[model samples]
Target: MTRTAPHPRTAVVACATYLPSTLRTTAETEERLRVENPTLTLPTGLIRRITGVENVHVAGPEAQASDLAVAAARRALEQSPGEVDLLIFASGSQDLIEPATSHIVSERLGTRCAVFDVKNACNSMLNGMQVADALLAAGQYRRALIVTGEVPSYAVRWRVDSREQFLRSFGGYTMSDGGAAVILEAGEAESPEPSGGRGILGSRFLARSEHWGVGTIPAGGTVNPHSEGGAYFDMDGAALQAAFASVGVGLVAETLASIGYGVDDLDFVALHQVARPYHDRIVEVLGVDPERTLLTVAEHGNLASATLPFQLAEARAAGRVGPGGLVALVGLAAGISLGAMVIRL
Candidate 1:
């Protein structure tokens, strides 16, 4: 059944995900941390205990962020073959700073489509969708591809200096390598038949940029490009939790309400998750039905921007969500951004 809307709309037609072949169990991750710093007396099982992260993907040294993106993009296009007018590489990790990673992805994929990069931490992919949707709505592009390759594992802190340093680097323990791709195409304009809407119905975003300091990979930028100190993940878990607490839980609910929907009306929800505790807290506060949301932190760790699309891809595969089903892509980013994008598939 096709949607019969009065105007053209950007529809998410395909979704796919990929993970690196190398897998590191929580035990191995902890052991590596301790081995690298023999003086480290940090407690064991802390990652599994606190984050429920049993395993995370680790890319080989030869693998690049663009490789992951291309892999996922290939899978998505294979699922729904077509030419793309634009490509957006929405990811936290890049192959290099000289050129946008999208260029690398396009070149690898053998596509010369207009390409660029969009970055906003874990919200990168969502923001890319927002941009694609806007452009499609304005008839500026016929179709766009949004892809992400998150390699937070590469920036993980392997050597713990002290308990305080471990606390600051705790977030890195749950880091994983992941890739995802989404295809967005403008639906045909206007039909008079009874309609069930398709594509992005509504989306809302709110950010407290001041929280940017709460989490960072302090190196490779102007501030610490030449220093080893800037090469690993640095985050204050307490500060990030406090920052999100200050933002409250109204964003998703209010966004849905504005679009005339309630939490129960959603068929499936994909919440950006970094850890089990944070995921549980968000689920409880939002009053979302735990059974209906995709919970992945325990298994895949933090997939970063790929989390939402990875969930979406899994839901579709499992029959939890499908064509004509209503779904919500809710995101919580490190820069303290909260958002929800409602879609009728």
Candidate 2:
């Protein structure tokens, strides 16, 4: 017996992104690091400048995360400009370990909606979309707002040798300080068919726990114990590349298949920005249209969990994504985790 697919009930209303005003050049990063650790030899240059810092000028980790989140949420709200029913904050990292970041943003935004945080490494934004869709489908809310913010600079490990090794730590350069927000609303359509609102068609996620350590903050976790030493991100570059080629590629193919659409069917694809090499590999593996693949890693680097949604906003603003178009948002990160979804418009 065959089964019928569930209908899409929620569609994205409006979306926007926030990028800090400050800029930190590659030379500046090197100079700043030289003061603390003179042995640093940077990669081809992937560092970016962020705003909201003190006399130091460059944005500190926590400040970058918060500022980006606030700015992006504001932009999204302005785009939609309505009373939001719910607010969800998604991020791989946050401004603080205590006091949920969503609550902080909610208070600042003057929003009285339900507030919370969603996290799953880099796939947090996509996961939040799934949750928002579920709530809207169930009629729990009429409209919901999703916000994602990332500050990779804080977790970056800067003291490494070799340009090859430096390039390995290049996730720092792909690190962007930004945030994104999108408004999700209950579709007016009675059936599952796509409409002007462009309801969510479907989504799939795959994560390999055994490979969670492929990329991680080594000293901060419970087992590693931050008390053992100062905590920092420790990436097994070799392992990550291997996983990207094997598990990462397989997951994208599988999810796209589940949704009954191949990469070619997507009008546009917005993926998590890690490094150009990784992007190239995924594009090659998926066999997607090069023109439709949007990238911001060069300018903004990887904004952790915020990458996908931020890209969505850019594509929408440029008129690359719109009503009746099919878009796929893909996010791949540390857990060897992958997320993808096919949405109409």
Candidate 3:
């Protein structure tokens, strides 16, 4: 039997983003790498040419992932201080492995909302959005706050033995520190002012567990308790590229089809800020106009789960997304997962 789709009752009311003050330039990073490996020979502008990232933000030593989340959450709350019935801390970076980070975020925000964490690598925010959409649609909750704080710089290994090691860790240079929060409210509730059908319409998610090892942190988990590679982030670049080339486009197309829309229907698209090449490939595969999407990698690099929300907020501020316009938020995570959410703004 076919099942009916859930009506979208959740709408994003406000969004806020917080980027760290410290900036790490590509030249500085290249210099550091060269100093560590004397024999290394890389083109002067190779990093920028490949990733289009000139600089990235670095969190202060005293800062933790939860701290950033709280900062962004406070800003979002200030914009729409409605009673948040639920809070989801969706981030790849966590303050601790024991207690849920959502609790800490809620405590700092002074909200007694029910809290939890939803992790799906870089797609954590999109996953959280899907969960929030469900709860709000079911009438189980009226408002939900989704927050992500990414401090990936901590996992970057500066010293490498060879070019292979450096290449494997290249993704690290693109890592940035930031936090983002979005306040979602049920659409059935009357708004103080009229919004032209601005809210989440639907979302689709796909996972390819076979390619799970394409991007991973080899240490710190039960599988590798001692960490053969010092718990640094590692990825098989070629494998990841191949996987995306094979299935990424199909996944996006299916997602759009689920909502009875196409790429042309999107007014603005917010894609994960992995790198310039990845972004270009996604735009090409999805047949989306590059001008319609916001590119943040050039300045902010990859903020993981915080990237999409940050881009969305910036696009809104620039008036790229307006009332009744459709916006597509797409993400690809380390689990070899793909997800797309179409929202009417």
Candidate 4:
């Protein structure tokens, strides 16, 4: 039997995730880095010691971002059989820069639906859903599939020439390669509640683009298109932490408060995870119970745009939240953007 959604307005029908079979442990990753960078004294266990990520998923060398998305999309489609009128490839990773990656995903899925791309660092999936929900509400389409695949492993620096260089690549170590897809159907869902909508209720986002340079994969753009040296990620971990700190938790708190519920009052919350310490700090400051949130980064590493969707799937499997359940999705992306969305599952 096909899994069906109970949401009426821009309701979520199905959500699925795909993790490559290969699991690369932090110890293995450190040894590999040390082996390739003989001149640099890279410390072992520091990755796990600092980030609390025990292992991460690694896609095969032959796998591209599109491949990952396709894998997850297939599962979602199989779970809920229906026509997908629009497809969106939203992620921090891509197979190539020329044609939109959504087209490639559509080709692999054999879907002749309208498609597009939305890339906004780690918040790509959230933004894609935002677009899809709005369009669905406007009657632009009947169903929308939002998919993401992240492959930060490929850009991870193997040849660390110096201690400083290794530090810049540290964030890459906490990243995992995987894919996730979410399906949202447009209709009036049957809800017993007063307002009577099950899908996305409201969303709010705040950004300070000035801090965009704090994190980046400097290649593939017009500025450094031809340089292999510019390919790997270069990030200031301290700066990124501080940037999010300065932005404050007002965005999330306000969003939840606007709906007359504090974060603790909600059944579930999906927060974009990067490192364990950061995750702890976020939940503590937000005053959300640890039991209500998913500490996914430590186990799955940073899934980038696939994170929020992954948490949603986990919640469903655990029976924490389902149809007519209240939930909130929060995102912290590299462009120094913070977003929060309230939803009735």
Candidate 5:
């Protein structure tokens, strides 16, 4: 016997993004590297050709991850239909190790609501949304604020000894500073169908624990504090690519299928902003129309978890997506986790 689907109870009412004012252009980055390492030689236009990132925003010295998160959250609150009953700070970067950064954001926003943090590297915001959705669906909350601030600029190591070191630092160069927030609220389900309304239709997450070491920050944690060669971001690009090739495409297909939809049913798709090649490959694998998916890596670089919401806000502002559209939010995190959330909006 066929079973009826559960009605969607949470709808994204508003979304906003904040980008730092400081700009770091590819030309400046290359010039600085050349000056520091005179023997270094990179092919002309290689950075732009490979990453497609012309510039990335850098947070000022005074700006912390929580600051950006608060900025974005305030903007979202301004546009929200109702007051926030809960706040979730989801970011890879945190201003402090204790007290949870969400508390700081709530204090800044003057929100007396319950607050907490959810982190999954680049997938933090998506995971936060999933939590909010579940809470709303369970009638535990009426309104929730999901926010992220990614200030990876602080982790970048500008000086490298050799080409291998430089290559290892490439991921840092592609990271930008930014924040994003989305307000989700409980709303009446659409008549006759759950997926017909402006709410999350479904979400799925998959993890490959063995690949957890693919991306990492080698220093600052309790396990390896003050260790040498552990101050900056490092990644295994080849391994990450292989993981995506082997399972990424299949995961996305499975997610869409679970929601009773396919890539073609998506009016817009927002994926993590890694680089040009990864973006292209994801679009190809999903069989999605390139024009329907938004690409911000070229301009904003990788904002970590903030990338998805930033792209969603930008797409809404550009009139590329609107009411009643079906959108898909996809994420690939450093923990070697993959997730997809289908939303009807």
Candidate 6:
């Protein structure tokens, strides 16, 4: 006999996000492109605007990873004042490799609850929510804070000599720096209805390890040794395209079925902001309602880990999503990973 999976009880109470103040427009990129590679075909200003980013602070040796978290947390607290019982920092851009960045954020936010970090390429936020939901279900914590801080600008390589390298700068210009903080609380009948009492139902992860090298920043890790070489983000764009085409279809279909619903049941779907053509294909194939899908790539660009919360915030502000809405947050990025989660709001 097969046993049924139980839905977990959880709710998102408040959310806050920060966008860097600096700006980089596509026109600027085109101008630079003309100077660097006169032969390279460039997207028109309107077509390439998402390749523009603005108002960002470059994280550096002296920059504390917790600074972005603290800024977002403060705003989150102000938005919905509370005493959090757990803190989870999700990112692909941690300040360091050793000591967890969560510790610094917890101390700065004055949250004494358990603290940890979750790293999973761009899906880090969704992964954090899954962990937070599990902890809440286990009675390990009553409330949790999920935060994401991005510094893609810090990873850019501006002096490369190859045209291939010039085109790759899309990652930098197409990416933006920002942070987000969200408060999750255990559902209570008296919980004042919560921002919708949206409980996380289930999540699915698809990791295609074989394509791990398709999209990555090769230079600074254990493999290449940053000390001996110049490190910058690199990608086999063709391979990533194939991966998205194949994995996106199955992962999305399975996720919807796992929740006993079709993609049409979703009131809103938030996908990772890659600003690529494949994003449109996935939405069409999944039959996700165009009106319900939030696309931030054209404006905010692709924020590695902060896309989920940023889109959710947009949906909320626009009143496009509300109580009783079924929301799906999906992400696909480096590591050839794809993740989808269904939340009942």
Model 6 clash count equals 10
As for TM-score, the candidate ahead, 3 or 6, is 3
lDDT of each: 0.88, 0.72, 0.86, 0.88, 0.86, 0.74
In model 3, which residue pairs have backbone atoms overlapping below 3 Å?
none
Question: Once superposed on the true structure, which residue ranges of model 4 sit more than 4 Å away at CA?
Answer: 1-8, 189-196
Q: Which residue pairs clash within candidate 1?
A: 324-345
For model 6, which pairs clash? 20-55, 21-55, 22-54, 22-55, 22-56, 23-54, 23-55, 24-53, 219-231, 324-345
What does candidate 4's lDDT look like per residue over 1-345, in tens digits? Answer: 664444446788899999998999999998988789878775667889889999899999999999999999999999899889999999999988979999999999999999999999999999999999989988889999999988989988888778988898889987999999999998776654433467777788888999999899999988888856758989999999999999887888888776566776688989999999898999899888888898888878999999999999999999988788988899999988888988888
lDDT, residue 135, candidate 5: 90
Residue 176 miss distance in model 2 (angstroms): 1.7
| Model 1 lDDT at residue 301 | 86
Compared to the true structure, candidate 3 yields what TM-score? 0.93
Worst 10 residues of 5 by lDDT: 188-197
Q: 78-109 in candidate 6: lDDT tens per residue?
A: 87787888899998778677678898888777
| Residues 1-345 of candidate 5: C-alpha lDDT, one tens digit per residue | 665664755888899999998899988878887888788887766788888988999999988999999889888878875678899999999888788999999998888899999988998999999999999888888999999998999888778888888887788888999999999988776644535567888788988878888788877678676657756888877787787667755777787787577888888999886898889988887898999998889987888999999988999999999988889999988878888898887
TM-score of each: 0.95, 0.85, 0.93, 0.94, 0.95, 0.87
Please identify which of the two predictions, 2 or 3, would achieve the higher lDDT against the true structure: 3
TM-score of 2: 0.85
- Give residue 292's error in model 1 in angstroms: 0.5
Residue range with the least summed lDDT across 10 consecutive positions in model 3: 189-198
Instruction: Give the least accurate 10-residue stretch of model 4, judged by summed lDDT.
Output: 189-198
Show where candidate 6 strays beyond 4 Å. Answer: 1-8, 33-65, 188-197, 225-227
Pairwise lDDT winner, candidates 2 and 4: 4
Superposed by TM-score, candidate 2 places the C-alpha of residue 89 at a distance from the truth, in angstroms, of 1.1
- Tens-digit lDDT string for candidate 1 (1-345): 765447555789899999998888999988888789888886888779988889998888878999899999999999889999999999989999879999999999988789999999999999999999999889888989999998887788777778898889989888889999999999875433322368887888999999999999888888887856658888999999999989987888877887678899999999999888888988999888999898898888899999999999999999998898889999888987887898889
Residue pairs clashing in model 2 are 23-49, 24-49, 46-173, 174-301, 174-302
